[model samples]
Target: MSGFSPEWLALREPADHAAINAQVRLELVRVLAGKASPKVVDLGCGAGSNLRGLSPWLPAGQSWTLVDYDQRLLDAAQARVARSPLSPSPREGGGTSVTYRQADFSAGDFAPLIAGADLVTAAALFDLVSVPVIGKLADAVTANRQIFCTVLTYDGIASFLPEHPLDRAMREAFNRHQQTDKGFGPAAGPNATEALAQAFTSRGYRVIRAKSPWVLDQTFERLRRELDQGWANAVRETGAVPVREIEGWIAHRLAAQDAVTVVGHEDLLAVPV
Candidate 1:
């Protein structure tokens, strides 16, 4: 799997937290309500943004096994979480406990990581993986009767205000590049949410999905700038558009004072019926 730097993850964390679907989270709260302590395994944890976002809603005394390919990120996650109010010392009683594990599910078995988890959760991950991998995940979750929740999966919709002539072309090229392998097989990309929903539903699990789009305005200037550069890079990789046009589009987007960028994403909550 591709690695994400802590700085990049940090920059996007606020938007990611804001974009999470409240309804899906409410449903998850209901699903795990009765458990005294929920064991959650977070895939591609990446500095533990998902944990920091969702931990407060969960029951106290929760235990988390944060799994990531990068040990540096795991270390970062631990340090950050330790500083948060959420990670109170265990002696305080009912405080959350966390452990980090370095593992690459793309090249290793997933069953062990999820073996005893009550909930298997990930954020900003499914879109980068293949359908078969999702299916296998559904199978394991079903077998263990674990609740599955994933958020911030890109769905191929990106719109910018004060639209440029090359907007459509840039978006098309970027979406195509998204399907390229990110260490997994060919990615599902924009179709990931639908694929994940179908995978769980076909196994008789109840799946709920909701829109979780990033709506960035002037207040998110830094994130918008980063996104502009990232999209330009991805579009360049496809070679479907001229380099000059891509550069122009990025320049126009960054320079626009009243710019707004909305990137569509979806969140899913699957529960065993």
Candidate 2:
């Protein structure tokens, strides 16, 4: 919830599934290109992963502004940008022409900072925002005609060897948990994609939807562990079953020596319609 638990970040970064999502983000940039110097703003930038990923595709002279609620992530993102291949000013001329800003996207008016940017983006954030807030964002972006993209939304499919029923049960429960908004009021969870798509279409932007699903193979231990924990927590949160049963079910799946794959989808690419 706060900073993605360090263990979670460690396992997530090296995930093979992440590679697919990164590729989708890259393509999102390619589809919306037509500017001399685009001002790219990454909303809920989250350590600047999306920014760093977009650097190569973006114009060399282009500027970037990273926004997040956490200062710690902002600090780390700036440091990464300084060392990134796309650093605007090399040779110690200046430390990355990138600007880091702290802002709350849930309640505050976003048009002033984002209204005129060539592009605005976020990773794995759409499913977590409520419909009304997304409506406001669609209004703002439509007014400015900013290109927007988001990546890695969870679609809730988990499979392990032997095909246990618990896997299906846990996944559904987790999807429900994902819908529970953390602090930005009520959100409809994984279904946020539709709200975003509808909002953009109504405003007159041609939307290109791409699904980047994370399909993990059995060889990846880190991904297995992350999915296991995520499934367990989702089931536990519901208080619908006994803790011992959940433990036993998880143990059985992990103990079996076979390939396990969890499928999750992320939506990408929204342009002026």
Candidate 3:
């Protein structure tokens, strides 16, 4: 409810899936390889995309707690888990089970869900949380001795080909704007992955980081256009450029339809020391 729309999330799900570091996911799956029916808690599990995306990489007996603030998203998530072929089916080994919870992790109490959890995971989430809250999550992971993995956190790398004069300025301003509160006082913005890794490391956990950037090509014109519009909106909101310039930038972006853009992201996996 407080985050992206289902339409946007659905539109980006495939890119998110492809952009996830496979090696990182393989390592995570390896860590929980021997566990019998691991209990996983996914923070901000919007529409169960992560579940569908990563479940196959994991063993069959995977059980997930898909937590989010919106009931509609949770319902959609439930429906997806029930119907998606990517999800473990009934006849499959052990199969996969899911439970939904409506709670905002931004400023909500989620310690209860971490208890007895084998893995605490989230995708595209760390950037939206504050430092103290991330520290609290680190403490909980240590207390429960659970694995923490987060993916698709923007790392401030944005590229547009046939560049415009305002490209760097607009991106820098937008990054600053990203720090504006998204429910967690001054979000980490581009520094999210580093902040989280540091939090777990200070608590004596070993962290693994991987690059998982989205490289949109000509084939992805629609997705790229939508993403560019989002950048335009972000830059506009920050008042970094005048409305006329912003419009011109947007126009240039659309004009360069064949341009390839790479949006950087990082994936993190932390395990107890």
The model with the greatest TM-score is 1
For residues 64-146, could you state the per-residue lDDT of candidate 1 as single tens digits? 99999999999889999778657542332488888999998884368899999999999999999888888888888898889
Encode model 2's per-residue lDDT on 32-65: one tens digit a residue: 4556567788887777776655655665466788
Which of the predicted structures, 2 or 3, would earn the higher lDDT when compared with the native? 3
* C-alpha TM-score for every candidate: 0.96, 0.85, 0.95
Q: What local lDDT does model 3 show for residue 237? A: 87
Task: Report RMSD for candidate 1.
Answer: 2.1
Backbone atom clashes (below 3 Å) for every candidate: 0, 4, 0
As a TM-score, model 2 comes out at 0.85
User: What is the full ranking by TM-score, best candidate first?
Assistant: 1, 3, 2
Off by over 4 Å in 2: 1-7, 14-27, 83-96
lDDT of 1 at 43: 96
Instruction: Judge candidate 1 at residue 76 and give its lDDT.
Output: 89
Model 3 CA lDDT for position 153? 94
Best by lDDT: 1
Instruction: State the lDDT at 172 in candidate 1.
Output: 89
Which regions of candidate 3 deviate over 4 angstroms?
Answer: 85-92
lDDT of 3: 0.85
